[model samples]
Target: MDSQIRSVLPKTDFNRRSFVVTSIAAGFALAVLPVGAATITTDTTGLVAGEVKIPVKGGEIPAYRALPVNGGNNLPVVLIVHEIFGVHEHIQDLCRRYAKLGYYAIAPDLYARQGDVKKLTSIQDIVTKVVSKTPDEQVLLDLDATVAYLAGKANTDKLAVTGFCWGGRIVWLYAAHNPKVKAAGAWYGRLVGDTDPNHPENPIDIASKLKVPVLGLYGGKDQGIPLASIEQMRRVLKEAGNPSEIVVYSQAEHGFNADYRPSYNPEAAKDAQQKLLAWFKKYGVA
Candidate 1:
């Protein structure tokens, strides 16, 4: 094993196992069961979409990938990090949406080694058993592994990354972690919070170190992420002279881009999507 992977490995049974969730689930997570009627589904027509295994330090983890069927190997690459729900149908759909726009999109199962959140019935349980146990270092390594897996398949030189909720927070850390990334779009990701050994720093802690421009799309009504924290992050970015920017939708709540949730805001989601694409294009990820 690489010394770096060994250093970040959680001193738990996880180190003894190859993987917990070997494959991506087929539908929405049970925690979000009874998916809302407003859920949006993207068709895979004219697209090559399905599951594939990405090799990591220990073993291979599954991921959902989508790209235009006729798109050559030089297609722009976009890494789609999934929410806490894991790489369920929604995340897969997002990959398809990106493929329709001529980008090779892939969402790796980051929680595969920790546990499967899709089987858990409650969000609290999922967080306690999986999310909380997942080390930030491990997640970043897995994402790096995912990118490495794209080496000959996509144009990594035009790499971009975007994520939602838990994955969104990762966007900030990843932008700082990987200099090859051209742009990033973070939607409703936490900016600050208590840290542990595994999570040594929050997004705010590295705001000044960001070399890749990030477009943060936030929901003003998200009680979990206070307006104060957003302002704090904004102030830090401004003081650092970072090109990163944040947009707040006053009427939208957390998970506003989640079409399958009651908190979904169509207007905000649409606008945020446009901004995300434009941000990527402006930063040369298009």
Candidate 2:
């Protein structure tokens, strides 16, 4: 598919009300294997963890969800979108980490509707075959549906979104799309890009329209995301009323938070996590 992805939600009869529950009963795990770092994997001993099929446009897309041991009403929900590599092991572990933090987190395989990037050998192939073909509008709608699913299960009033690499840009778009969101944390996502009619805009373009508070965590050494682009994005955000903040760690590079990656910076990751917690709490997502 050379062109941007066509709308997939409406075609699937996208239903959020009963989607999460229907997925809750389904089996999941071993969708992908470990590749790098001592990727943190939290036990689901006292928690609800498994695979679920989110009802999308026509067919249901598979995803992994994790929640607290003692489930209650209206728990804060975090939509954990994945990097360009897709919703593999690292992404699933992230959902568990958020679950440990008391938030019901879900990592939907957004790429499932397209193709599994994990099966592809090269990142370049993954980008061209999967990522590029993905439409921005589709991602926003899927995430919105995920929120609605969680809202039905827990309180979504304190909703927050977090994404890594490719997902980081999505966090920005979601914050702009949903005013109900309390906050968002974007990790080293791209700032600018070419526009298409199907893929209408980029994060920098949406800075002025952003409605919710967002914390952008970036790396100065990142090859793909230059400091200048980050600065330009900052300028745009400052010009807007939201004043969303972006932090660039001089020593870090892209995927610094992913322990499995060579560029993972322990200090930077810990500090960023602290700030992310504080940001969420300040914005009421805690």
**Candidate number with greatest TM-score:** 1
How do the residues 1-286 of candidate 2 rate in per-residue lDDT, one tens digit apiece? 1112223322222233322222222211222234455556667877888787666665566778889878686689888988877777677778888988999889887766556676676666766666666667778887776766665788888788899988998898888898998889999987786666545777888899999888999888888787888999999888886758998899998889987666789889999999998999998887
Which prediction has the highest lDDT against the true structure?
A: 1
Give a tens-digit lDDT track for model 1, residues 112-206: 99898899998778776778778888889889999999999999999999999988899999999998999999999999887766677889999
Instruction: Evaluate residue 37 in candidate 1 and report its C-alpha lDDT on the 0 to 100 scale.
Output: 95
- Poorest stretch of ten by lDDT in candidate 1: 1-10
Reference-based lDDT, each prediction: 0.89, 0.76
What is the Cα root-mean-square deviation between model 1 and the actual structure? Answer: 4.5
lDDT for position 150 in model 2? 66
In candidate 2, which residue ranges exceed 4 Å CA deviation? 1-34
